[model samples]
Target: MYEPFFEMTNTPFRNDIDTDALYLSSDMSEVLSRLEYAAARQLFAVVTADVGCGKSTAIRRFTSKLSKENYEILYLSDSKLTPRWFYKGLLDQLGIESKFYRGDARRQLHQQLEIIHGIYKKHVVTIVDEAHLLAKETLEEIRFLLNTKMDSHQPMSLILVGQNELWDKLKLQHYAAIRQRIDLKCEIPQYDLSQTHEYIAAHLSYSGGAKEVFTDKAIDEIYRYSAGSARAINKLCTHALIYAAQRAKKLIDDHMIREVIAGELP
Candidate 1:
């Protein structure tokens, strides 16, 4: 509804925006580098962030940049995942039917990974997202999964990505065994005020409209309410855009943002 009003060729703040077009803040850059290192060495890594803080975006970019010829990436995001299903889920990604029993499935997955590593000369990178919700038995299975070849090396790179509570959970004494295996730890911090400003500008740039369509005061209001969460910013901006279009306003000011927050946003 707002495209013509803003002279934008495409809508801004869309979730389906291309990864190449997305903004990469400084912290994101560093975290991406660490993830790259983890993938290369087949190490265990833990990535944590606040809700809607771009954890999925960073993983998307990182996986996109990986060479398919040298790497195979497997992704799973089940909150109720169990040990048997965990092995089965990864095996299913590789087009293998898992055994009904957990132990058999584990061995079968390991055999496939070893063949891929030793023969095909390709690395397998497995990412378990929303890992904060994994049960205690499943997490213990993770530590054991890494203990192959008499605790020599891991067959595949394992990355656990979750909200901040994941790391907090790992800090407890009960989870220390798995926590000790994490070779790299990265946290995606929420954007500060300036990064939030740049984030809006970058996304708006995709619209082919003036980046200043959102005023400085408007951003201040957005940052105040969103606290620099990218998802919240997108929601607020999308609503503001529609509100502005309905009212025939090309520019979004602080009052417009406030109205959107009060009337539309929770």
Candidate 2:
């Protein structure tokens, strides 16, 4: 309801992970560095962050930046809770047949990996998203798969992505071995003040809001209300814009921002 009135080319605050609008804050930069280092060294990596902390976005960026020739990657986004389901999913991803029964899926996967290792000059990488939901047996199976060897080369590089609760889950003594295998652990912290501003501005620019639809005070209030989370900031700003345009207002001020928070922004 606000595009033409505000003279914006697009909506500034869609929730999708737009890499073009990616704001490289200090914590995000550090996470990227750790991920890069781990991938280059072919080490196991664990990337955990609170929900809406941009873990999926960061991982997508990392994967896109990696050299395809040097890495054969299998990325599993929808994860199952069982070891059998996980292996079957992997096989389906690789376009390999999972004709074997669930009990034989692991062996078949190993055989497939052996073939991949033989043919591919670069490392094979498997990234499991939402890994915290993985069942104990599934996780154990993952550990075993990572332990495989292929003529001195490690079986594959494993990158597990999950929400913050993953850390607590890993703290269990029974999961110590899997935790130990994680060569690197990186957390994606919420954005800080400066980062929050940059993040909002970035989306504005993306949505053609460079003419200052949101005033300085309005931006600050957004940061305060959002608590520096990109998702939260986006939600507030998007509605704020709609609220302003509906009122035929040209610039968003503190009162307009208050209205947004008060659920009075139509």
Candidate 3:
């Protein structure tokens, strides 16, 4: 409803937005560069951030830039993951039929990764998203995977993407093996007030809306309520636009943001 009023060619605050249109703030750029470096070196890396801080988006941007011929990237995100299922998922992504037992499946996955890295001369990058929810057994299996070839050579690069709790989980004494193998640890920072404004304006501009569609006061309210979370900002801005459209308002102002925050507007 607000698209016509705002002259937006597409919805701006959508969650599944194209990575090409993402506003790469300095912090985001640095995280992406570090992720790329981990991939290039086939190292075990951990990336953690607060919920809705755009860690997955950063991973998408990084993987999208990798050459298909040189890299095989497998992405897995399952909150209720188990060791058997984890091995099965990896085999599925590698196009290999999983073995009947978890042990056999694990060996098969390791062998396949070795072939991909040594025979095909391509680095295999496995990205496990939402890894904080992984069972202790599953995490232990991950550490065992890293132990292939007695750590002489990294068969594949493993990237764990999760919330801050994942870091705490890794710090446990029982998980020391995996913790020590993590070569790179990165955390995505929340946007500052200035970055928040630029983020909102960039999204609006990318969607063909005028940068001034959201007034400064409205942006301030959004930042105040969202705490610099990209997902929260998108939710607030989307509702504000809908509310403004319903009231036939041309500009999204602080009042509209307030209404959205107070649940006065759907």
lDDT at position 242, candidate 1 = 90
Which 10 successive residues of model 1 have the least lDDT summed? Answer: 10-19
Question: Candidate 2, overall lDDT?
Answer: 0.80
Runs in model 1 lying further than 4 Å from the true structure: none
Model 3: per-residue lDDT, tens digit, 28-68? 89888888898899999999999999988899899999999
lDDT of each: 0.93, 0.80, 0.89
Error of 2 at 213 (Å): 2.4
Would you estimate the TM-scores of all the predictions? 0.97, 0.90, 0.95
Best by lDDT: 1
lDDT of 2 at 183: 84
Kindly list the per-residue Cα lDDT of model 2 for residues 160-264, writing each as its tens digit.
999988888998999999888878888888888788878877777777655677788888888888788777887888788778788889889978898889984
Cα displacement (Å) at residue 222, model 2: 1.5
How would the candidate models be sorted by lDDT, starting from the highest? 1, 3, 2
Q: Write the per-residue lDDT of candidate 1 for residues 1-266, one digit (tens) a residue.
A: 88888888878898768888889999999999999999999999999999999999999999999999999999999999999999999999999999999889989999999989999999999999999999889999988888899878889999999999999999999998998999999999999999999999999998888677889999999999999999999999999999999999888999999999999987
